[model samples]
Target: MLVGDGARLAEAAGDLQELGLGPMGTTQLAYLDPPYNRGGSFNGYDDNMPRHEWLAYIEERLVAARELLAETGTIWVHLDDAEAHRVRCLLDEVFGVEAFIADLTVESNPKGRQLDRFFAGSHDRLMVYARNPDKVVLDGGIAAAVNPADFPHVDSDGVNFRLLPLRNTNKRFNPMTTPTMTYPLYGDPETGAVAVDPGPGKVEILPVFGDLTPAVWRWSRDRAVERVDELVCRTVRGRSGTRIDIYQRDRHEVGRIKKLKTIWLSQEVGSTDTARAELRAAGVDGFRTPKPEALMRRIIELSTVPDDLVVDLFAGSGTTAVAARDLGRRWVVVERNPDTVRDVILPRLGLTGS
Candidate 1:
């Protein structure tokens, strides 16, 4: 379903409720890409509004949006530096501070805009909050593409991996700071063999590997021994002389899923340039600062599953709808701009009714 009037979404919410949609807690996820309070011109909406008016407008919509969310649902609010801090405070008030999940920094522009006095602005913020954080279970182990060049080494099992230093390198990390990590390992200088005890040909290895200020190991002795098959000894020629260094083979061929980080660069997501090209390819125009479908797809995949209901209040170019459709998710999008809804969005979505 498409809503043509976004400014009065509270009224639209009532209509949806009458239709037995999102009565109290039915929506799985709500992805909002509302206008940033920047003094700029959009196609049919006013981008510049008084700070107080903008806050009040957003708060009203948030109240209605929260009502539609399920107990395990989440809301992702996308904004820029102009109102990100204010939006965060508003969300805390609406969703409770304890329900706040993450504040993700999306690098929309790789080449940042130049500023006269301040640092360049290149990223946008996405504030995520859960209806009930205690009941919300996020799938944090999302797999991302990794460059093969970073993991050039191959293990004995013919798996691509990289070797990481077993000993911690930070000077602040010492035995006093990490008592359990302070342990001894014996290694052979000639054969590159390692053990947990001093032997005839093996030299005793301490937590600190170097003669200078040393640091402790990241893992405990027992933990290291448990996965010793992944560990290996290498003889490296340092400035001092040849030294035996312990390394842990970080297998790249397995366990691709990793915890999602806070920062997402344009290379990871799609950039504004990529978004524009996608629109142009689809014969849609006059949409400035439209989000990339790939970005929307990422958000949808992370926060929802197949057939889940997704809502987008500011459906600028209908990217979210298109992404949801392609990903086998249901979506209800609202666009205040009639021209965009009729000409660009409806045509792109192949829909005739609002």
Candidate 2:
């Protein structure tokens, strides 16, 4: 970790460049949680900076950060309401508007700030960007977990799965929008038998709403035909007798990828309260806005995998590095406070007795 106690990123502007990091474009992820321009103070760190200076500082870091990413890599900038909008524009300017990925609203302060000028703010923004748009590779990985109990049904071959609607139920997804997805299939309502083509003792079923509004299938005919074995026909008894409904098996497998949403709020993802508790539990103190390792873990999991290089310029309490290490990733982190490095970070990383 590079030790440089300065006015946040201003006095220590060359910290990242001077570190002699890996090749220019070898890093897979860069997590930046620098001192927010809150126009106030936090502990010994002064967060009050002129608006232009603050933006310039962030712009320098962002420009330098873009150089340290691989084609498949991404960057996440953590900031509160203070500078999110301005930083968003800065990010777009630095990493082209086309590279903008997500604006993850992290529910950090679940209890919402009590005293404010107008309304309470409960979330922090995580501005994400890709070095190369076409090569953006994000995998929610193990962090995107699902309780297997939800998929309780066991298949004949001893696979756990649950039946899901095979039709695209969304109003926008219909014969009017995706005509190619509208097709006919044969099914036996009584026997739960299904086929892509006409079969004896089978009835033709079309994807439609209960009111007979034309709808589309989630899959195309060719894909549905190729994975026909994965589909099932179930008999549904509504107000009007029985009808065959096409279903798809949502199998519970070893590796399941869950799509990360825009707004994050979960115990596992953690919050500002959990972050303070984590520091206290680690026997560390003095960070006014330290992030929980779980939050960092989630971000790292979404962007990278094991052995990938993760860089953190504003390491602070070092939660990002801790999460990266625990997840089996190689990391290069910088902390401006030497005392934090010797006292809190080193001990937290198990590198020092203290």
Candidate 3:
């Protein structure tokens, strides 16, 4: 379904309900790329607005959006540094703080924007929130191609592997919050055997290295015990005495799927220049900023399955619609600019009318 009136998203959603589309929890994913309120002018819409007015504008639509989302649905709001914090607060109010998800930082521009004052702006923020966090389904195991040369060590089975530190690197991992990850790991100095309990040949290992600070493990005791075969322990001679270091041997297998990270680099996701080029190739003009199809494809693949309903409220150049259709997903788009909807979106989608 394509809508030429973007301002009436709530009304459009109501119309869909009448057509037996979204009766109150039917949309699986809603991807919004609304205007950033940076005083920019597009073909038929003005992005400039006062702070309070903009917040009110977004809040009303968001209220309607919340009603259209399924119990396990997710919404991604794309914005810039201009109103991210304020928008986050609004989202919290609209969707409840418990439903809030990750604030993904997308590197839309690889080359930082040149400015005479202050630092350069290079990234845009994507706020991801779910209607019900416990029930939300996310296929985070989307892998990116890696070079074999990056992993140097060859295991006994002739598989290339890399040693990853067993200690938790994130500062947010506090023992107070997660007591299970604060336990000590006993290791044998001679042999590379590790044990959670003290034994005759095992020595108690300190979480930190000579530092009084508390150390935390990435995995809990039970998890570590379950994956003991993948663990590698080595005895290292230090100034204090002999200490055992724990490592996890990560094998480099072809076509391996890994969890997607919050930071999306421009090299992995297409940049602004790539988006412009794509629009030009599709004979689309007057749309100043368009998101690349690669970015939309990645978002769709990460959050949805084939035949899932995807909604794009700010359908600029119709990149999301095209990406969803190509990926075998159903999509509904709304564009405020009638010219863009008629000349660019419909033509690109091979449709004659809105």
lDDT of 3 at 46: 76
lDDT of 1 by residue, 91-144 (tens): 999999999999999998888878625978888999999999988856664666
Each prediction's TM-score versus the true structure? 0.81, 0.91, 0.80
Q: Candidate 1, clashing residue pairs?
A: none
In candidate 3, which residue ranges exceed 4 Å CA deviation? 1-4, 10-13, 18-23, 112-120, 139-141, 145-150, 156-158, 165-221, 239-241, 252-261
- Looking at candidate 3, the ten consecutive residues that score lowest on lDDT are 206-215
lDDT of 3 by residue, 103-175 (tens): 9999987888887268778899999999888899777657664567778999888999998868776656757
* Candidate 3 steric clashes: 0
RMSD of each: 3.6, 2.6, 4.0
Question: Evaluated with lDDT, which candidate comes out highest?
Answer: 2
Cα lDDT tens digits, model 2, 74-96, are 99999988889999999889889
- Estimate candidate 2's alpha-carbon lDDT, on a 0 to 1 scale: 0.81
